[model samples]
Target chain A: MKIEDKKRVLREMVLHRRFEERCYQAYIERKIGGFLHLYPGQEACCNGVMEAARPGHDYVITGYRDHVHAIKCGADPKEVMAELYGKETGSSKGRGGSMHIFDVAHRFMGGYALVGGPFPLAAGMAKAIQLKGGDEIAICFLGDAANNQGTFHETMNMAALWKLPVLFVCENNLYGIGTAIDRSTAVVHQHKRVAAYNIPADECDGQDIEVVYEHARKAVDHVRSGKGPYFLELLTYRYRGHSMSDSRGYRSREEEEMWKQRDPIFILRDRLIAAGEMTMADYEALEKETDAYIENEVIRFAEESPEPRVEDLEKYVLAERETQLPWLTGKAA
Target chain B: MAQIMYWEAIQRAHDEEMARDPLVICMGEDIGVAGGTYKATKGLYEKYGPLRVMDTPISENGFTGLAVGASFLGVRPIVEIMSVNFAWLAMDQMFNSAAKVRYMSGGQLAAPCVFRSAGGAAHQLGAQHSARMEKVFMGIAGLRVVTPSNPKQAYGLLKSAVRCDDPVFINEHELMYNMKGEVPDGEYFHPLEGSEIARSGTDVTLFGYNISVHWCLKAAEILDKQYGISAEVVDLYSLSPLDRDGIRKSVSKTHRAVIAEEDEAPVGVGSEVIAIINEECFFELDAAPVRVHSALVPQPYNHTLEKAAIPDHEDVVKAVLKMFGKA
Candidate 1:
C-alpha cells in the first residue's frame, strides 16, 4: 500500500475507535439511547474495506454493528449521531435508530438489524448494477455467525450463477452473541464455504488495516472486472460485549485482554510512531481533536435537533394515497 | 376485449408488465419452468427469459428479501408464493422490510413490490392451505391488500399494483382462478385501496370480497327473484385503505347490512366491516349488522366438511333472510 493510503486508513480507523468509545460513555450517561452495538475492536475491518471501494459509486451494506461503517462511508458524523439521538434532523428523520442507518446518495444502502438479512439484498443490488450496465460492486459486511445462515448459501449461489458484482466480507470475530464460530459451524474457514458456489475466496488479518485494505482492494477489483462475486474472511475479535445488556459470560476475561493486546488502533498508532511518520505528541493531538469533534456533535444532536413530530408517523407509509383511481367507485358486493 | 379466467388475467398482467418495463421481473419457486403451481406465471419464462423471470429455491425468506432490495434499487418485482400458507415464511420480510421500508426511510425509499399468492379453501386442501389471511395483512399499516373476484378486476388491480410505489399483497382465490370474465385489451390500470359496489339495490346492503363476492352476488340475485328484497352487494377490493365512505353511503340508502367473509367468524374481515359500519353509520342502519362467515374451526380435509365450513351461496342467502327476520 502507498504511504499516503496507509496514513489515511490509520487516521480514519482511529477516528472511528474514538468516536465509538465516546459513544459508549454517552450511552451510559443516557445521552444516546436505544441499542448501541459498539464496533471499537472491529474498526480495522470497516476502515479497511471502506478505503478499498470508491465512495459514491460502489454500494455498501452491512449488519447492525454499523456506526463505524457509516462514518467510514462518509456519512456526516453529526447527522449519524443525531439519528442515534432520535432527532428529526437525523438521517432517517429519527424513524430509524442505530440499526437502520441509510444514505442512498452516498451508496450506503443501510445497516440492517436482522442477522444474515443483508446478504440477499447485496446480491440483488449487484444484480441491479449488472442489469443497468454498471461495473460498480456491492460490498456486504457480515459477522462470522452469518456464514452459517441459509441466506448466505442462497445469495452466494445467486451471485455466482448470475456473476453479479458483489464482494462478501465476513468479519470473523469468532463469537456470534455467545456462540463461538467453532461450536456453531462444522467448517470454521468461512472463505472456503464460498468455494461450494465456485466463487474465488481469500482470508485476511482484520486486525491489520493495511492487510485488510490490500485484500479487499484485490477482491473488489476482481468483482469489478466481471469475475463474479468473491468472499473475504477477515480473522478478528471484538473487545466489548455484543450489546449493552450482554454480560459476556460466554468468553473469559483473559480472552478479552488477549484480544485487546492486539487492538487495531493501538497497533497502528505504535507502527506510525515507530516509523517516525507520527510522534507521540501528534497522536495525542489527534485524539484530542477527535474528542472535541464528538463532543460538539453530541451537544448539537441533543440541543438543536428536534424530536420527530407525532403526525409525521403517518406521512411516508404510502406514496400517494390521495390520487384517486377511476375504478375505485364505492365497494363491490 | 377477451374473456379469460382470473388466474389467466393475473398471468397476463405479469407478462404485460414484464414486457413493458425492463425493471419489472418475476421470482418464485415453480414460477420459471413449471410456470407457477397454479399457472399464474405461465409462459413468463419463455417470453422474458431466465434473467427477468427467475426460478428461486423454496427459500421464501431469502427471495422475498431479494425482491425487497431490488425494489429499493428501482426494480418492480412480482413475488409469487405457491400458496399463501408458504407466505408465512416470508412475512418477516413482508411486514418488517418491504412494508416498513418507505416509512422507516422517511420517503427516501419505496418498496414497489407485489406479493401474489393463492389463498382460501379449495376442495379438501385442508386447514394448512385454507387460510383467508388477507385480514392479517389489512391490519398492517404500509401494505395495500387487494383481493380481486373476477378476471377484469384481477388484471386491472394487478397492473396498478405493479406500477404503484407501495408494497401490495394480492390474494387470489384458488377456486375462482378458472372462472372466466371479460377483460379489456391494451393498456389498463385499476385502482387499488378502493372498493366496488358489484350489485346496486335499495332495501339491504351485502358486503363481500374475493370469493365471497361471487357468493354474495348470487345471493342478491336469488333474493331479488325469489323475494321482493333487492339487496345491494359491495366488494371491498382493497382492505387496508378500506372505502368506508362508500360502505356508509350504501348502508344509508339500504338501512340494513350483511357482511360475508370466507374466514373464521371471530376477528375476521366481517368483524372489521361491522366495526366500521357501527362507528360510521350507526344512525343510518335499521338493524344491527349481520355477519355471515366461515365456522371457527380448522378447515376439514373431507370435501363435504370443507364445503360446510366455508360460506357458500346458500349461507349468504340464509344470512340475508335471517337479517330481514324472514328465516
Candidate 2:
C-alpha cells in the first residue's frame, strides 16, 4: 500500500474509534436509547471494506453493530445521531431506531437488527442491480451467530446458483453474545462453511487493515466480474459487552486483555508512526478534529432535531398513492 | 362462457398470469413435476420451466422467506401451501417478515407475494386439516385476505391478488373444488376489498362469505318459497378492508340481517360483520342481528360428527325463520 493510503486508513480508524466512544457516552447519558452494540475493537474490518468498495456504486448492509459502518459508508454524522435519538431528522425519520438505519441515496441499504435477516435482502438487491445491467455489487456484513440462521444458507445457495453479484463478509468476533464460535458452530473456520455452495471463500486477519482491504478488494472484484458470490471471514474481537446491560460473565477479564493487545486502531497508529507517514502532531490534530465534529453532531441532534409527531405514526405504513383501494381513507360507513 | 370448477379457475389464473408477466412465478411442494397436491398447478412446470415454477423441499419457513425475499426484488411470487393448516409452520415469515417488511422498511420495500392454500373441512379430514383459519390472518395488518365463493370471483380475485403490490392470502374451500360456475374469459382483474350482492330482495339481508354464501342463498330461496318472504344475499369476497357500504345498504333496505361464516362463532369474521352493521345501521335494523356458525370444537373425524359440526342450509333456514318469529 502507498503511504498516502496508509495515512487515510489511519485517519478513518481514529475517527471511528472516537465516534464509538462518543456513542457509548451518549448512550449512558440517556441521549441514545434502545440496543447499542459498540464496534470498538472491530474498526479495521469496517474501514478496510469501506475503502475497497465504491460508496455510491456498491451497496452495503449489515447487522446491528453498525454505527461505524454507516460512518465509513459516508452517511451524515448528524443524521445518524438524530436516528439514534429517535428524532424526525433521522435517516429513517425516527421510524427505524439504532438497529435500522437506511440511507438510500448513498446505497446503504440498512443496518438490520434480526440475525442473518439481511443476507437474503442483500442478495435480492444484488440481483436487482444485475437485472438492471448495473455493475454495482452488494456487500453484506454479519456476526458469527448469524451464520447459524437458515437465511444464511438459503441466500448463499441462490446467490451461487444464479451467480449474483454479492460479497458476504462475516466479522467473526470470536464470540456471539458470550457464546464462543467453537461452542456455537461445529466448525471453527467460518469461511469453509460456504464451500458447500461452491462459492470461493477465504480467511483474513481483520486486525490488519491492509490485509483486510486486499482480500476484500479481490473478493469484490471476482463478484463484480460475475464469477459468483465470495465469502470473506475476518477474525476479530469486541471490547465491550454485548449490550449496555450485559453482565460480561461468560468470558474472563484476562481473555479480554489478551485480545486487547492486538487492537486494530492502536496497531494502525503504530504502523503509521513507524513508517514516518504521520507525525504525533498530525495524529493529535486528527483526534481534535474528530472530537469537534462529533460534538457538533451531538448538539445538532439534541437541540435542533424535532420529535416525530403523534399523527405521523400512521404515515409510511404503506406506500404513498400506491394502492387505489378506498378502505385506507379511514371513513365511516 | 363455459362452466369451470373453483380449483380450475384458480389454476387458470395462475397459468394466465405466468404467461402474461415474465416476473410472475410459482413455488410450492410437489408443484413442479407432480403438480400441486390438489393438482391446482398441474401443467405449470412444463409451460414456465423450473426457474419460474419451482418445486421446493418441505421447509415451509425457508421457502416462504425465499419468496418474501424474491418479492422484494420485484418478482411477483404466488406461493402455495398444500393446506392452510400447514401455514403455522411459516407463520414467522408470513406475519413477521412478509407483512412487516413494507412498513418496517418505512415503505421503501413492497412484498408482492400471494400465499394461496385450501382451507375449511373436507368430510372427515380430521382436526389437523379442518380449520377455517381465515379469521386469524384477517386480524393482521398489512395483509389482504380474500375468499372467493364461486368460479368467476375466484378467477378474478386470484389474478388481482397476484398483481397487487401487497401480501395477499387466498383461502379456497376444499368442498367447492368440484362445483362448477360460469366464468369470464380473457384478461380480467377484479377490484379487491369489495362485496358482491348475489341475490336482490327487500324483506331480510343475508351476509355470508366463501361456502357459507351458497348456503345463505339456498336458505333465501326457501324463505321465498315456503314463507312468502324476500331475502337478499351478500357475498363478501374480501375479508380485510371489508366493503362496509354494501352491507349497510343491504341492511337499510331489508331491515333484518343474518351473518353466517364457516368458522366458529365467537370472535369470528361473522362477529366482526355483525359488529360493523350494528354500529353503522342499528336504527335501520328492525330485529337483532343473528349469526350462523360452526360450534367451537376441533372438527371430529367421524362422518356423522363432522357433518354435525359445520353449519349447513338447514341451520341458515332455521336462523332466518327464528329471526322472523316463525320458529
Candidate 3:
C-alpha cells in the first residue's frame, strides 16, 4: 500500500477507536438502547479486508460488531450514530439499532444480529454477482465462534461447489460473549476447518494492519478471481466485554493488558512514525480532531435527529405491503 | 386458456418469469436435474441451464438463507424445499432472516424470494412428512404465506410471488401435483391477499385452502345434493393476511360457517378461521362456527389409522350436517 493510504488507514483506525469509545459513553448515558457490540480492538480486521477489497463496490456483511465495517463501506458515521440513537435520520431509519447498520447503496448489505447468519447470505450475494456477470465479490466478516455454526460448513461447501466469489473473514476475538474459544470450539484454528470443504484458507495477526492487509489482499484476489470461496482467519481480541452488560471476569487482566500492548491503532501509528511518514504531533492532531468530530458532529447529529413517528412504525414491514394490502394503508381497492 | 397439471402450471410460471427476466432463478434439492420431487420445476433446468436452475444439496437452512441473501441484491430466487416437513430446518432463515431483514433493516433491503414447498398429508408419509405448516408461516408477521388449490392458482400465484418484492412462502399440497385445470394463456398475476369463492351459496360458508379446498368443494356438493344446503366454499389462498374481509363477507351472506382443514385442530387453519369469524362476523352467524379437522395425533403409518387420522370430505359433510342438526 502507498504511504499516503497507509497514513490514511492509521487515521481511520484512530477514528474508529475514538468513535466506539464515544458510543460506549453514549450507551452508559442511556442515549443508545438495546444491545450494543462495539468494535474497538478489532478495527484492523475489517479495515484491512475492506481496504484490500472494494469498500463501496464489493458486497459486505458481518455479525453485530459492525459499526467499523459499515463506516469502511461508506456508511456515514453520523447516520450510523443516529441509528444507534434510534433517530429517524439514522442509517436504518432508527428501526435497526447497532446490530443492523445497513447501507445498501454503498454495498454494505447489513450488520446482522444473528451469529453465523451472514454466511449463506454472503454466498447468495456472490451467486447474484455470478448470475449478473458482475466483477464484484461478497465479503463476509464474522467472528471465530460463528464458525461453529452449521451454516459455516454448509455455505463453505456450496460456495466451493458453485465457485461463488466469497471471502469469509473470521475475526477470531478469543471469545464468543463469555465462552472462551478453547472452551467452545472443537478445532480452535478456524482457517483449518475450511479444509474439509476444500476451500483455500489461511490465518494471520489481526492486530497488525500490514499483515491483515497482505493476507486480506491475497485472499480477496483468490475469491474475486473465481477460485471459489476463501476463508481468512485473523487472530485477535476484544478489549471490552461482548456487550455493555458483560463484566470481563472470564479472562485475566494480564491477558487483556498483553493484548492491549499490541493495540491495532498504536501499532499502525508507530509504524508510520518509524517510517518517517508521520509524526507524533500528526497522530495527536488526528486523535484530537476525531474526538471533536465524534462529540460535536456525530453525537450531536444523532441527539438532535427526530424520533421515528409512531404512525410510520409499520414502514419497513414489507416494502410493498401498502400496495399488496391496500386496506391496511386505507387505500381503496 | 390452456389446460395443464398443477406441477406443469408451476413449471410454466417458472419458464415464463425466468424468460422474462434472467434474475428469476430456482434453487432446491432435486429441482434442477431431477426436475423437482413433484415435477413442479420440470424442464426448467434444460431451459435455464445450470446457472439459472441450480440444484442445491440437503442444506435447507443454508440455501434458503442464501436465496434470501441473493434476494437482497435483487436476484429473485424461487427456493423449493422439496417437502414442507423439512421447512422446520430452514425456518430460521425464513422467519428470522427473510421475514425480518427488511423490517429490521428499516426497508434498506427486501428479500424478494419465493420459497415453494409441498406440504400436507400425502398417502401415509407419516407425521414427519405431513406437516400442515402453513399455520406456522401465517403467524410470522412479515412473511407472505399462500397456498393454491388448482393449476390456475398454481400458475398465477407463482408468477405473482416471483414478482413480489417481499419474501413469499407458497405452501403447496403434496397430493395436488397431478390436479389439472385451465389457466389463462397470457400472463396472469393472482392477488396475494384475498380469498376466492370457489362455490357460492346462501345457506352456509365452508372455509378451506389448498388441498382442503377440494374437500370443501366436495362437501359443498354433498350438502347441496344430499342435504339441500347451499354451501359456499372459500378458497383461502392467502393465509398470512387471513382475508378477514372475505371471511366477513361470506359469513354475512351465508349466516352459517364451517372451517375444514387437514391439519390437527390446535392453532391450525381452522383455529384461525374460527377466531376471525368470531371477531368479524359473530352477529351474522346463525350458529357457533365449527371446525372439522384431523384427529389431534401424529399421523400414523397404517392405512386404516392414517385414513382415520386425516379429515376428508366425509368428515366435512358430517360436520356440516351436525351443525345443521340434520345428521
TM-score of each: 0.95, 0.89, 0.97
Determine which window of 10 residues in candidate 3 chain B has minimal summed lDDT. Answer: B184-193
Model 1 chain B worst lDDT window (10 residues): B101-110
The candidate scoring highest on lDDT is 3
For each candidate, how many residue pairs have backbone atoms clashing (under 3 Å)?
12, 0, 0
Candidates in order have lDDT scores of 0.85, 0.83, 0.90
Model 2, A177: alpha-carbon shift in Å? 3.3
Better of 1 and 2 by TM-score: 1
Task: Please write out the lDDT profile of model 3 over residues A1-333, one tens digit for every residue.
Answer: 788888888878888999999999999999999998988899989888888999999999999999999999999999999999999999999999999999999999999878899999999999999988988999999998898888888999999999999999999999989999999998999899999999999999999988999999999999888888999999898999999999989999999999999999999888888998889998899999999999899999999999999999888888765565432222223
Q: Model 1 over residues A48-118: C-alpha lDDT tens digits?
A: 87778887678888888887777777787777887888888777778888888877778878888888988
| CAPRI band for model 2 | acceptable
TM-score of chain A of each: 0.94, 0.94, 0.96
How good is the docking of model 3, as DockQ? 0.54
TM-score (C-alpha) between model 2 and the true structure: 0.89
Candidate 2 residue B264 C-alpha distance from true site, Å: 3.4
- The candidate 2 chain B region of ten consecutive residues with least summed lDDT is B101-110
